[model samples]
Target: MGDSRPVYQRIADDLRQQIDEGVLAVGSRIPSRSELKRTYAASDQTVDRAVRVLKAAGYAEGQFGRGVFVTDRSPVGSLLRTGEAVDSPFAARLLAGSSAAPPLLWEATSTATGAPPRIAERLGIGAGDRVMCTRYEYLADRRPLQLATSWEPLALTEGTEVVFPERGPYARRGVRERFAAIGLPVVKATELVGSRSATSTESQALGCSPGQCVTVIERTHHTADGQVVETSDIVLRADRWRLEYHIAFPG
Candidate 1:
């Protein structure tokens, strides 16, 4: 049967297969516009459409004054989720067991602000409630790899040493440890994972192409009494990282 698919689509599929088979290795330049036009007997518009499809699907990228090229799809690293994540900084948990690269860096800025509706809901507080919000950018193998924003209700830590997550004597301590010092021992946690196209802000911040796929994690930590302690939203490029989870089953 003839391919009912469009010419541009068939072209994209063939290129994708070549990429998968390593015939077109990462960093290898794809055929130029004129070359593809001649080879496929395709119009300039059809060839352009095929290239756009490759870029959008993350199969290729274009360089200034250069033709499109296959992109490296290997993950930069993985985020390890284990029992220790409750007490470890998010950046520290990334590839801690693997020799990813020396010197992981986490840049963070915390501000006292009112929670947005979505964040408020995750933290189980009213919209616009006061919370200490911290934004983080993590570099793995010295590449901007992940971004996260955390919201902690001020009601639970007002005037306390841990009020500012990135400041004070308890700064940088994980929620379970820091909250335990103040009488809230976190006992439960949950995460909802999903994926969608990266937003413009995310694309610029992470240095990836626009419309790339990203994994979104909505995570919450709860105290023994069932009160939520902290919640966070995390984003990472789908082509550059994998999420690994570890669960301990009590014998």
Candidate 2:
């Protein structure tokens, strides 16, 4: 007896095998719907459904008015857990197999708003307290790979040049440097990691299906005296990235 899988699933599985085995190269055009139909003796609906599955699985993407093409299928930079700070951006230099200049790019915007209950609690502030919120998207070779939002209590940065994260000289500077400039030195940090299904908006922003999962990293930065200076929520496509760690052996 032949395989019992549905026609669409069988087609998707075979295409995935070709992608995995290098028969389909990254960024290369996949066979057109008509071609696949002819090759598999399937209907238009079957081929269309198979292509959707490939897109959802990050194996391929359809270009409007053009055709579907294989995606990079490579993992973005790994997140390194280390002792120096809470979380360091694992970027360009750490990208595997990427020899291009500036392997990653950043698009970010900052807004001043009242903190929500959850964010306020994370930053040790009361709900509705004033805070500076900055949202960012990290792109690898112009493709969005990660999203993050950082929140800081306005009380700590008020009257300082660092109040507006993207407007001052301290803009885009690391947390420690920004804090040091404001007389609040970041001495310790903590992080928690989890995963959940992507929301509709998140999936749209990430070009993934809503059913896909995302990895979330919650990071908090603290001053030496235990003041919460900053807290951030980082989200990444679960299938496109991996977490890494570097630590020294105990003395």
Best by TM-score: 1
Q: Model 2: what TM-score?
A: 0.78
Q: Per-residue alpha-carbon lDDT of model 2 for 133-184, expressed as tens digits?
A: 9898887667677889999999999889998766789876778888899899
| Worst ten in a row by lDDT for model 2 | 85-94
Position 213, candidate 1: lDDT: 89
For 189-244, candidate 1 gives per-residue lDDT tens digits of 88898999889899888867778889898889998778999998889888778888
Cα lDDT, all candidates? 0.84, 0.82
How many pairs collide in each candidate, listed in order? 0, 0
Per-residue error (Å), model 2, residue 183: 4.1
Off by over 4 Å in 1: 91-100
Q: Cα deviation of 199 in candidate 1 (Å)?
A: 1.0
Supply candidate 1's per-residue lDDT for 33: 90
- Candidate 2 clashes between residue pairs 3 or more apart in a chain or in different chains: none
Q: Which residue pairs in model 1 clash with each other? A: none
Best by lDDT: 1
